[model samples]
Target chain A: MKDIILIGSGNVATHLGNSLKKRGFNIVQVWSKHINNAKILANRLDCESTSSIKQLKKADLYILAVKDDAINQIISQLKDITIVHTSGSIDIEVFNHRVSNYGVFYPLQTFNKNVDLDLSKTPICIEANNKKFENKLMNIARELSRNVIQLDSESRRALHIAAVFACNFSNHMYTISEKILSESNLDFRLLLPLINQTVTKLKDHNPSEIQTGPAKRNDKQLIDSHIIGIKDAKFKELYTLISNSIISHNE
Target chain B: MKDIILIGSGNVATHLGNSLKKRGFNIVQVWSKHINNAKILANRLDCESTSSIKQLKKADLYILAVKDDAINQIISQLKDITIVHTSGSIDIEVFNHRVSNYGVFYPLQTFNKNVDLDLSKTPICIEANNKKFENKLMNIARELSRNVIQLDSESRRALHIAAVFACNFSNHMYTISEKILSESNLDFRLLLPLINQTVTKLKDHNPSEIQTGPAKRNDKQLIDSHIIGIKDAKFKELYTLISNSIISHNE
Candidate 1:
């Protein structure tokens, strides 16, 4: 059995650990700076939990599912094992000169601890220092997901930035949409069909090719009216900036 | 059979026209400023085509699916007939005293004429000059969609603005993501899982409650690095502004 020590107990860690557990991987322990978080996730993962890095058990794999900035701190304290971090932006080279075997096993999907997501459908981007470890990581990734791809450090960095724009920033747009609707006692659920259809259309072509709306049509009169109608300065600014961006794309 | 004349041959007009045609409604004519556009849609709709308002035959309903600015021109030419404009932001009163029986039939979904969409699931927002006409519009809307909503002009306006943020602006975010991926030779399709997952999580919670990323986490380090990494001035501005907005939401 491939024994694994899943580090971190946040959304990414919790989801990845549970998904791995489902595949019959023996998770030796779950580690986090907070003992309660580790314990909570570990209990659900059917594994041991620890707050201290010193108490972490040696396993076939160490999945460093910690936050981006904290990655270096955790790396400085571990050695002599095949370790991988689940991050989109962080470089695989962060493990250089510190760990004997290090790579990246990044699943390119948004994670929420409570949300049930099929991690197998997510695109896993993998990278490693050497061919043998790369193949090993790819093997594990292939077991978990159908859409696995090899991406270098720079490409992964680009993918991460793209993800931030596509997922995080776009999600903020939905948040703004909900806020706009609330101003007039409208239900956010009313926009779900539009939202779902927006995503569904992406399967056909590039987003830029299929752009729509007043901005795409260069409806300056309607755009101006929308801006004037918006009360918040930040939203107004966002409306204008994003609208202008869309118009520029049309040109 | 109740006769209907669909005005305009654009994305909204084409999709709604075809969906109505499928429901066995008698579409009498397709109208557009350009004769070619009118002819193209009329051919697909199996109806007559006209470029001049003078050539428009009287019908039970005149569906004005034209652009916002040209609505006035189209309305001035018709009278003593039930006329409805398919716009989110436009009020039913755009026909105030200009026409006898008027209403609004707004389908709150992004439309692409070339893309296949199940219009039955789209939420059709209806408003009218009178209760009887409202019911008439409601009946037509109900026939095409399962989610027919009666929104007074004000709420519909807010919903329209929200739709822009949720659909149009969010799509622009996807466009930006694809542009960023192109910079590093990464496939845009790789980000689809992340993008789709972003929308999926919304079903379980409010978008603001579930915002994730360096911005949501307040990882100033990652945000600053991402800003530094972006070469385009506008993209950098978008990155900083949206990140600040996400951070603000977290607080």
Candidate 2:
């Protein structure tokens, strides 16, 4: 069995560690900048834990699941290990001249530390420097997920940006909706079915094709009412901007 | 069985007609400003179709599923036949002076003509002036959906605005995501799994609690990179505005 070491204790690291352990991969060590977090994650997977880079034991694979900025600083302090990052935006070239073999093992899904997700169906995007190392990473990734594919750094970067709009910005829209409902003493729960159906529809149709609302219909009166109804200046500005965008995109 | 005459043949009208017909309700007639639309929907439901209000048959219920602006003009031509309008934002009292027994039977879900929704779990918000008519509408709504509840005009309006944010604006985020991916020669399909997981996470936790990405982290560097990377000025502004909102909301 190939031994793996996780280098972070955040959402991604926690999830990856758990899923890998479930798949019967030997997770040899877990490390984080904070000893407390490292210990917490390590205990769950029954692995060795450390805060210091010097304490990292020799493993077949080192997964750098740290923040985008922290990757450079952390990678700078270590060398000569087959490594990969789980970042969406950062280029694979960051490990150039620093490590003998490096690649990316980005899982394109939102992770929550407390929530348990079955990584089997989640898309595992892989990238590697050399053909041999690429095959190694692919073998391990296939063990964790059925949807493993080779994705280059350039395409991965584009996917990350698109993700910001789809997942992050989309969730922000939910937050804004919650805020709007709260102001009127209405329960946010009322919109849950609507939100679910919005996504459920996408399972069959393209989003641009299924787009609806005052903006898509160009119902000027309704759009104006919504703009005036939104009390927050920032939200109102967003309402106008997004509404106009929807109108234009549909046209 | 309640003999219903559906006004307008738009998304809501079409879906409502189909679901009601499936529930064994008698859809006696369908009407629209355009005869073509009315004929199309009416043919599907196996009902009489008309472009003229004078041609509307006498039915137990007249569901004015027309546009919000068109409601007043359409209602002006007909009265005193136990009517209801399926609108979220419009006042229930809009029917108070005109009809003897009128109510609101708003289905709180985004509708598409081609896609058939079960409506079994869909929340149908109802409002009426009297208990007799209210109960009558409730019975009908219950036949169509298990999630029938009484929500007044004020709360419904609030919920409508929130739906615009959650359903409409959130879908716009998908459109933007697709646009970004298309520009990079990346298949929008890669982002579908991510989008699915984003919504899937919400089934267990609050959106604010489960929120991820650079904005939630308040990672200045990553956010700056994304802003610079976004070629569209409007999208860039949205990125900044929404990123700031996420940061503040979390803090």
Candidate 3:
């Protein structure tokens, strides 16, 4: 587990590679289909860079950190190395016992290469085929993050779905908010305090329990006004759908 | 103004009342339709308390921080003093020129009385009938918050609408996430890192610009898998709706 190869050079790979390298794991190789992508991350990790999959160096662990579809293609090309992926939605069965040891090392955090992240605070979900490998993977995951959990494939899938609702859908709401504010020349920054408080509240309370607004209050009049003013068909539909969902959850 | 009477005793009222009191404003009286509510806030402010509208004290500024529907009823009872309501959706025209002094002092933040808040970081949206009073309201708002703006009814309404999408709708996303995780006996806290990162990213980029998910990547197979797994009719519908919305936004 001390020697590692990070198989992607995107945001997730960039963050994880640096974090693992910081924890004194030797990032033996950085691999991407594009030489430039591999070179960029390799430069940061001070490791060997490669666009050639067949040229990959043997390491104790090879993190298959690539696109979900690309996982199969890359894994099939390698032999006899422990492999794990950093995908929330992908199944652990993707390994199909290709090697003696394989697992999933999905970090439950959104990553942007340009943005700073405290990997120690992020939750890492680990899954392996056997107890021995699971312990090894857990130790590696624990080295980078204080929060690590051993999750099975089914539970990981459920968690991934929940992550979509919490992170992706929540961000879509912000997209819609930015659109609405732009129409009236209002700065998006005006909503920062309110946005900050919304997430801050969840630290202690359930989302439905602290829910407020016309939808939660079941104020039909206010909801009606919000729906009527929306000119974008998609946004209007979203407004009505979500407001009704909130009202339903309240009931 | 220096002298103020706070009408209402909810989260907004409690926060605004305490903030104004701390700023050295003389709170002549705290009034709520319920005597207990008035007494509770008054005890905290160390001021006079009243439930009777007729017993409301005369002050340089009267902040009518009641529910939106109750504004007209409460204002019809107050006379010969400056009046302002702290509502996001309600138009300032609700004042109807009944008094020489009327305005709105809407704070653009979701407040919880039990939660500690830094009011100076919150935005105060003020609107008044006359420039003299607008300046006065602005000065008072500035005292409480560094982020204060004199917004008109139309723009204020726009900002309010945006807040609903940003705060209320985003929280609803968390509600759905909690519901999904509960079905699998998974802890909701597992999603916090992802949730925190989602909001934290907005400080540097627009939501639409930073969007990343199956839908954002236009991965139809992943989206289909998610939609198919949802058992709740409302959630299934919501998943499809929001996914399509994200896809449409990406295009």
Candidate 4:
């Protein structure tokens, strides 16, 4: 069995560990600065939990799924093994001195411990310093997912930015919609079908081609009315900015 | 057979016409100021086409699926008939003098002629001047969808604003994602699963509860990095504004 050591107990780490466990991989240990978090995930995976980086057992692969800012500090503490980080924007060179074999294993999907994840459907983006490490990561990734893509640091960063736009910003749009419905004593659930349909269009249509609304149609009257309808100053500003952006794109 | 006269050949008109035809409604005519647009839709429906509003034939239901600005003009031209406008924001009062049984037969979803619409799943928001008309409209809506909702003008307007946020703003975010990916020669297709998952969360979770990002986590360093990474001035401003909004929500 492929031995794996996860160095975080956050959403990504916990979820990935669980997925790997289900795939029959040996999750030897889970490390977290927060002992309770580590214990929770480790107990679930039937593995050991440790707060000290020194206690981390050497394994075939070490995934440092720590926060982006804490990556450098964590790498500095690693005991020189095949190390990888599940970050999209961070460069692999940060681990050059600490670990000879290092790379990125970014799963291009959001992770939440409460939600079930289908790893097979999620895209796994892999990168490594050498062909040997790359092949190792590829084999592990192929075991988990059918969609695996080799992306360099620059492309990974771009993908991360795109993810922010598609996932984070899209969720914020739902947040705004919730606010709009709440103000009017209307159930936000009323807009759920429309939200589902918007995303469904992406399966076969380019977003620009499937785009619809006052902004896309250049309906100034409707756009002006919508701006007036929005009660919050910040939301109104966002509405205007996005409307202008849609208009710019259409033109 | 229910005789349906389409009074506009715009996106909504074309889509609604096609949907009704598939459901076995008798489409008598397609009317538009642009002769070619009306003719094109009419040809597809195997119905007559008319550019002149004065030439409109009386039918069981006259669907005025034109722009909000054109609704009043079209109603003014048509003599007494059972007229309805497929507008979410416009009130039925606009057709009070023109038709005694006027109503709003708003489809509470976005429409694009190029995309296939599943009307059975799309909620039809029905509102009429009286109980009889409401019942008539509700029966018609029942044939098209299982999710028929009775919404007053004010409620429908609120729903429209919410739809704008969910569909229009959500689509704009995808457009932004596409632009960001295109700049770096990355495939936007990779982000589709994430986008779909974000919307799927709305089916069972509240938008605020499902929200995740640097702003939601209050990660100042990540937010700063994201703002710096976005090259466009407007996009950066939007990121900052939305991030602030999400942070404010948590507070």
Q: By DockQ, who's the top model here?
A: 1
Two-way TM-score contest, 2 vs 3, winner: 3
Worst 10-residue lDDT window for candidate 1 chain B reads B73-82
lDDT of 4 by residue, B173-215 (tens): 8988888889988777888778877877778889889888778
In model 1, the runs with Cα more than 4 Å from the true position are none
Q: B1-251 in candidate 3: lDDT tens per residue?
A: 69999999999999999999999999889999999999999999999999999998778999999888788898888777798999999998998889998999999998888888989999999999999999999999999999999899988888888899999999998998899899999888888888888888888898888888899999999898888878899999999999999998888
Candidate 2, pairs of clashing residues: none
Please compute DockQ, using alpha carbons, for every candidate against the native two-chain complex.
Answer: 0.86, 0.75, 0.84, 0.75
* lDDT of each residue in A99-160, candidate 1, tens digit only: 77889999999988888899888999999998998999998888889999888988888888
| Model 3 ranges off by over 4 Å | none
Would you list the C-alpha lDDT of every candidate in the order shown?
A: 0.89, 0.88, 0.90, 0.87
State the lDDT of candidate 2 residue by residue for A39-120, as single tens digits.
9999999999999999899998899999888999999899698899999999999996688789999999988788777788
CA error at residue B182 for candidate 4, angstroms: 1.2
DockQ: which is higher, 2 or 3?
3
lDDT of 2: 0.88
Q: Judged by lDDT relative to the true structure, which candidate is superior, 1 or 4?
A: 1
Interface RMSD of 3: 0.9
How well does model 4 score by local distance difference test? 0.87
Model 1 CA lDDT for position B13? 93
- Look at candidate 2 and tell me the lDDT of residue B221: 91
Instruction: Give residue B240's error in model 1 in angstroms.
Output: 0.5
Candidate 1: deviation at residue B67, Å? 0.9
